[model samples]
Target: MIQRLLFAGLLSGLVVALFAFSFARVYAEPTIERAISLEEGGAHKHAAVEKGTISRSTQRNAGLFTGVAAYCTALGGFLAIGMAFLHGRLSVRPRSAVWTLALTGYVALVLVPQLKYPASPPGVGSAETIGVRTELYFVMILASAVCMAASVWIAFRIRRRMGMALSLAIATGLLVALAAVLMTIMPAVSETPRDFPRGLLFEFRLHAALMQLIVWGGLGFLFGRVAEHVVEHDRPAGVVRHRIPNA
Candidate 1:
């Protein structure tokens, strides 16, 4: 099952890479180019130099695809492991699981931390604080992951007593409160240049968010289908079943 999931994950990574790359090329790339142009046009502009060993063509093509694919592959593996732990427990069907995985992934991985440390264009942040920014971002990621897990456990426990709907509601409220508190307490990073185009910044962040939605949602649905097929085939022969039931 793990082996099959790994293969499924790699395939999903390809799917993510295709969509994400397309979106980046069309929407994000223009904004990025605009930012770079501004950087070069300003007083900080440097003299034009010879092309580096790794050409822009390669960076836009091979580098972009390879990086996204590799990251998605690893993400898929982690997602698969997480699902495995919840497989027999959750009452989720394979199709619903798609949303579950995608929503949880986006919330815990992207949305939560993004509220604190949003993505920036190339020239927005200072070079000197790159390391500090990176460290804080990752720390937020870790905190969000932990909080998500705890929320799930709390919801599960409450479900046993308060019932599913109410339990989920309570858990969600708690999670939101915790996340809000964290956002307030976490070190802030306000690095975007004052002169940067607000329109371009919004577009860049919007497209970036959409890319993640596509990657995670696409990967979840694909992996869920693959997992369902595997589960059906693996079920006992003597057991009576109808069309690989949800959950």
Candidate 2:
């Protein structure tokens, strides 16, 4: 099962990386170039960047591929573990589980934090605050995941009493309210310049979100199909029994 899931994840990650590389190359890369231009005294003379050892060609080509692959590979591995855990826990069908997880992961990890800290064009944030910003972003992701897990737990706990529909509705509402409150309390990072082109910023962020949507959506649908195949061929009774390999 682990082997199968690993194979599926790698395959899905590869496909996602291709799409991501294209999206970045077509939409995000130009914005980045503009940011680099700004840093080189086009718009923001004070924000000049020190030259790095890595060549631009490498950054645009090999670097992008490597980064996207590594990221999607890790995400695929995580999703595999999640699928294993969720195998028998929910009443959802195996395919539905994949779709559910895909949507949930995207919402919890990307959308929620993005609302609090939207993606910025290049040269928007400070070099000194990079560490701080990265930390905050991860913290928000962790919080969002925790909130989602809590919501799921709450729904399951109250299902026997409140019924599935009501329990889920209540839990969903609670999670939304909790996330909203967190977003409000978290310190805002406004790094984009006041004079920055609003249309360009919107385009950049829109493409960023679209790229994420493609990755997660592809993973969910692809993995779900693969998992369904595994269940049919590998399992003895054609049932999802949560059998972990060598556990």
Candidate 3:
């Protein structure tokens, strides 16, 4: 199970690579010359200049290394803990405990830095335009939350795993839903932040919400297997007490 999860994490890293490549817009040069040739005056030249700036921002971030590195790093961390647990060096309880922390910490670590900049602000780019948008990163952030929630379920399946299971589920469910809704609204609101509505439904993004369900289902099967193994190890030792014999 540890090996398989590790492999899954590695595979996920590869998937990140595909997204990275797809986002590569480094050399997408605009017909700046063509536009200038046709219209030497009017608002067309100024608009072209503004577009050039957005395009340049797109080029600077079109690399694939960053995405794959982040995915592999998280997966590797989870797999390392799983290995220690498998080898008995790490107690099942500790393994179970850290899984929760690892997921939450990883999500924050990946996301917080993405939001630390000014240009990376929300709703500021087109779908084809590349850069770490807050909404998009939030979508990916659900991956770890979902993983940890399953780990909680694994803990629940054991003698005392129930509490953690329910707690993690509720937490993960909420995050997933929030992430999904943000994906939908971020794109729209980003396009027109000035006109975005501030109502009751403003809490969540559409893409992030729907993704939570998927995250839960996949993690459910994974953590179940981990729980089974952990429980087997934690089983009480057999007794060999001698019975009193009748005279």
Candidate 4:
């Protein structure tokens, strides 16, 4: 069962790579190029190529595809494991379970942390502070994941007594309050240069967010279908076997 799920996940990853790569190539690559150009100040156009380093063209093409493929592949494996654990626990259809997990994952892993430490293009922040920035960003993700898990547990625990709607409401309120407190307490990080083009920054971040949406949304949709098929196929023989009519 785990092997089948893993295969499904890897397959989904490969399928999603095509869409993600195309979107990034069309929407994100230009913004990245502009940022790189700004970083170089129009100089060193050929320095990297001449120095035997990978050129921007290669990075944006084959490199981009490879990186996306790798990321999605690993994500798919994790998603499969999550599905295995959550399969019957959610009391929902397989498709619903997969999508719910994906949505919650995106919020906890990406959206929450991003709100605190939004992604910056190359050359936006000081290299000296990168370690600190990375540590803080991961801390935010960890905190957000913990809050999400707690909320889910609370909702499940009280749903029978308080009712699903009210339990969910309470859990949501708790999550929001915890998120707000974390945001307020975490140290702020502003690394964009004063002279940086605001419009470019906005566009870059927008593209980044859209790319993530594509990755998560695509995975959910694809894996949901696969999971549905797997569940139908794997039904216990007793459930499907015809009983002799009191012979």
Candidate 5:
């Protein structure tokens, strides 16, 4: 069963990676090129190409696909393990359980952290502060995940008495409160160059968030379908007991 789930996850990841790669190649790549140009002080494209060992064409093509494929495939494997552990425990159908987990995972790991520290394109932040920025971002994700887990546990404990709707509302409120506190307490990091084009920065950040949305949403939708089939196939057959009259 674990092997099958892992296989399903890997397949879904590969499928989504294609769509993500296409989107990146078309939309994100141009933005990246422009950012590089800006970083190079509007130097000729060839200058930027000469600076890096890898050409822009290669970076946007094979390099891009390889990175996306590997990330999505690993995410898929984790998603499958989550599904396996959470399958019957949620008291919901397999599809709903899978999607719920995906959505919550995105919120905890991606959305909340991004809210605090939005993604920056190349040439935005200084090389010196990259380590500090990375450490802070990781801390934010960990805090968000812990908060989400705690809220879920609280909801589950009270769900039977409070009903699903109220339980969920309470959990959501707790998540929000915790996130708000964390965001307030965490030190802010503003590293974007003062002269950077605001419009370009916005576009790049928007694309980055959308790309993540595509990956998570696609994984949930595709994996949900596979999980349904797996659950039904593994379900035990119903047994009918016959009463025998005393002989």
Candidate 6:
């Protein structure tokens, strides 16, 4: 039983880690380019970056690392609570799909642009990128939200837990959002307010990270539980399940 639990924990952590690396790479790819500039042709194979640029990268990397880090951190959390898989009531393909859509859109459409330029073009970069770009991103955000709602609803139907899955997932999201909003908006009491523009940018990334953490953590916990229950109850106890399609 210990071995099984460890295996499950490791697998879940891997899921979270891979998603984190992939998602961060997607969003930070372009920005990483300019942050670490090509060096003068002094024969250094690697490029050099300014102290300011490196500082910026460090901040971005911290947020990106934390976004996926939640998954790994949640391991002992879910396990100790015995609902790491949300009692298996939250696990389902639909649930996973919803998370996938949201994460992908966030990394690709919402977060990536900020790496190269700014999320709100009017606010950060040149005026040339302001108009339709914002609208397109808003549309993508809406689509992602819709997918989350519909998928969680469907996952609820698959479990016999009387809508527990939906409630928990939604609750997790709301709690995270509330905390993030406050963190992003509340004015710091520090007297040094003028020096925080760059800090604000990285802090805002937490908004994106918070969402991913809630959704993916919930999915991993829920999926693990449901998968176990299905195998034990739906299939013959002694028979191993196969993934290939049947005739």
The local distance difference test score of each candidate is 0.77, 0.81, 0.40, 0.84, 0.87, 0.44
Residue 194 lDDT, candidate 6, scale 0-100 = 30
lDDT of 3 by residue, 1-247 (tens): 4555455544444443444333332211122222233333432222222334444334435423454356544554454455446443333443353344344544443432223221212222334444445555555445434544554444445423345446457656655555455444543323323322332113222222222222322233344345445545555678432422211
lDDT ranking of the models: 5, 4, 2, 1, 6, 3
Instruction: Tell me how candidate 3 scores on lDDT.
Output: 0.40
Compose the digit string of candidate 5's lDDT tens values, residues 1-247.
Answer: 7778889999999999999999888898899989887777743222222287888789999999999999899989999999899765666777887799889999999999999999988777776678899999999999999999999999988887888899899999999999999999998999776778789899999999999999999999998899788877776789432332212
Question: What's model 6's overall lDDT?
Answer: 0.44
**TM-score between model 3 and native:** 0.30
Lowest summed lDDT window (length 10), candidate 2 = 238-247
lDDT of 4 by residue, 1-247 (tens): 7788889988898899899999999989998888777777733232221222888889999999999999888888888889888765665677887898899889889998998898887658776788899999999999999999998899888887887789889998998888899899999998777777889889989998998999999999998899878877887866853322211
Candidate 2: global Cα-lDDT? 0.81
What's each prediction's TM-score?
Answer: 0.89, 0.90, 0.30, 0.90, 0.91, 0.33
On lDDT, the candidate that comes out on top is 5
Candidate 4, superposed: residue stretches over 4 Å from native: 42-52, 237-247
lDDT of 6 by residue, 1-247 (tens): 3344445545555556666666555664444443233222222232232345446466557755665666554542344234334333333342353344335434433343333233310023323433455554455445444544554554445434545556557644653454344334432222212322454445445544554565455445554554354335545667854432211
Where is model 3 more than 4 Å wrong at Cα?
Answer: 1-87, 94-98, 109-129, 132-192, 197-227, 230-247
Whole-structure CA lDDT of model 1:
0.77
| Cand. 2 TM to true fold | 0.90
Residue lDDT tens for model 2, 129-152: 888999999999999999998998
